[model samples]
Target: MTRRAVFAGWWVVAGAFLCMLTGYAVAYSFAAFFGALESEFGARRGEISLVFSISAFLYFLLGFPAGLIADRTGPRPVVVGGLLLIALGLVAAAQADTLWQVYAGYGLGVGLGIGFSYVPSVAAVQRWFVRRRGTASGIAVAGIGVGTLVGAPVAHWLIAAIGWRHTYLVLAAVAVAGALLSGWLVRPGPERYGLTPDGDPPLPSGASTMPAGLGLGEAVRSGPFWSIYAGALLMSFGLFVPFVHLAPYASDVGLGEGFGVLLIVLLGVGSTVGRFLFASVTGWIGRRLSFALMYVGAAAMLVLWSQSTSAPALVAFALLFGAFYGGFVAIAPSLAADYFGGRALGSVIGALYSGVAFGALLGSPVAGYAYDFFQSYTGAILAGAALCLVSFAITLAMPEPARWLAARRPGP
Candidate 1:
């Protein structure tokens, strides 16, 4: 790649980070808004959660279509439009007073926006880097950490000061600026620049070709694909419970609410470090090993949550668990790339990501129901821990893809 191509590549990565910041600021920032929504809207916990759940569902449900759209159209405009919709959702949310309005803003508006942006950003990033794809993707998606660290605190402050309505307005402003910038920075792939995905030359003569892209039918038939899919589902099952419950759980145990928000920031710190660390290591350790470690380590961290009552203990739990969570964000996309070629990477990964959405659809409610039934988060934590163990096993079962093996074979 020329210096110009290299610069363009980094610019695209930067755009992915920006897109992630917007998406995650909305996704991860939900915790801070939960309490306010319950109080201001007179909705039950389940009802309030249903709004966000619907949003998560729509995001995952729409991932396949969005990926198809990105493949057929391009990444830049899709991302830009999605950010605009997110901004509109926030603005509409700022005006919401009824349950239906809340549903509209939180569920429909944000859900559709996330559908447009998140997967395309990753697909675009993967198309840019080949040799160091893991590292590149990690850095690109690390915007989740930045959003958590910065957006969580700002969200808390905004909620306290102007109330949730104006907070949405502020987020809307940020989203619009981000969308405008992303429109300029991002483009489809190296293909537009007369290069292939990963900047590789055309296939060499007599290279064995596996089926290029697996449809959902073919994907379901493959053992390795199902393994990766199952792992993602398990990861999501546990992923949001800690975050969604962290504030209320802390307050229930007599810790300050502010500390609950601070714990999120702490989690973000761990996430920032974890993304870089895991990305760097995946290139050395390889994908399967790194994925297996992430799940096993996450399970250990989830179990540690049962020991948390004090602020310090909880903080420790968050740090460790947060790293594992961020590690998944880094590795999962690369895992998709490894198992499937880059050909239908967007749609295939989108389908896999739907499994995550399904888990999220179940996770928070189960935790909430468990808390309501048992009057503690203990049962939920244990369940999540068990799910992490299951994910570890599934990841461990993944076979090395035939392509990676074929690439290593000696040629005549």
Candidate 2:
């Protein structure tokens, strides 16, 4: 059978999945090492936590340039380069003896690498299937859930067995292998292979059929874009609060390390389920409503989390909160494509995701300071719930872009 007979988009999705899996595995593993770093570096909670916050900030900040590069040059080179940086970052972090060295190595290095890898990979996959864009994007990003599921527990074990430094070394090797495999599998949009998106038949005129929507400049100036951007920023402020703090919080409330890790795994399970479930229903409910509902659910879960003091209660909160959190993350790229169109999607999506950087940058360190000052997570949890409520309101106000709405009507 000819190569075109088999859809190549699925292969691209697979490559995107592996890249996300490996990249996020390293990113999310930060929580597992939190305590070790604190003990090793003689740092306070806020001080050490800044490492993750700084890394997350750079991860989001660098996405803008990375996406621009991918839009111009394609995704393969970006992913390959990102993977190498991730490996190098880990290697540098593994050799570090000081807090600043750790920040320089793990924080900036991993952040930039993930920033390069993530936006390009997602944008590339979205270009392959218009009809199934939500599902395809959902499936690809579900790797974050899978990575968190496996990475947290593994990191916990590795830290216990061989120490956090060796764990970094091991993860560096994994990143290198993942990068090589991704280089082999990832390709640009279907046009590169002389096929149309979703394997559609060639047009009669043999002209390019890619949809050209709002250019980057127009998208930036539009009201709908700001609404979406605002919502993303607000949502992110609360989105990662738990990821960075829940493990340590569990310990403070007397839960053991094993249970703490289990909480993270449970959150990952919920995230996986939510991503697939919410994405599947977007066709019926529409992207905005689906996203808004998740925000409401997340806010409710955060409220419940703030009141919980027992193990069982925390587990329930972890699962519910994680599901809604994953749903929000899963839908973002599809929402951007829906609102903005495929042309310049990399740049538009990258710019939008910078909100994630600012939010995460503020969230982790702020929450850490709150905990250190008050000796309680109650205030932080309440703040997260409040941010989610604000995000939900903003999301509710967002209308489908005029351009997108115009494109849907029957021709005169």
Index of the highest-TM-score prediction: 2
Candidate lDDT (C-alpha), each: 0.80, 0.87
Residue 391 of candidate 2: its Cα lDDT? 81
Task: Give the range of the ten consecutive residues with the poorest summed lDDT in model 2.
Answer: 400-409
Clashing pairs in 2: none
Query: In model 1, which regions exceed 4 Å deviation?
Result: 1-5, 196-220, 402-412
- After superposition on all C-alphas, the RMSD of every candidate to the true structure, in Å, is 3.4, 2.0
Residue lDDT tens for model 1, 195-266: 555545645653323235455556656777778888888877777777777877777889977888888887
Clashing residue pair totals per candidate (backbone < 3 A): 0, 0
Candidate 1: worst 10 consecutive residues by lDDT?
Answer: 205-214
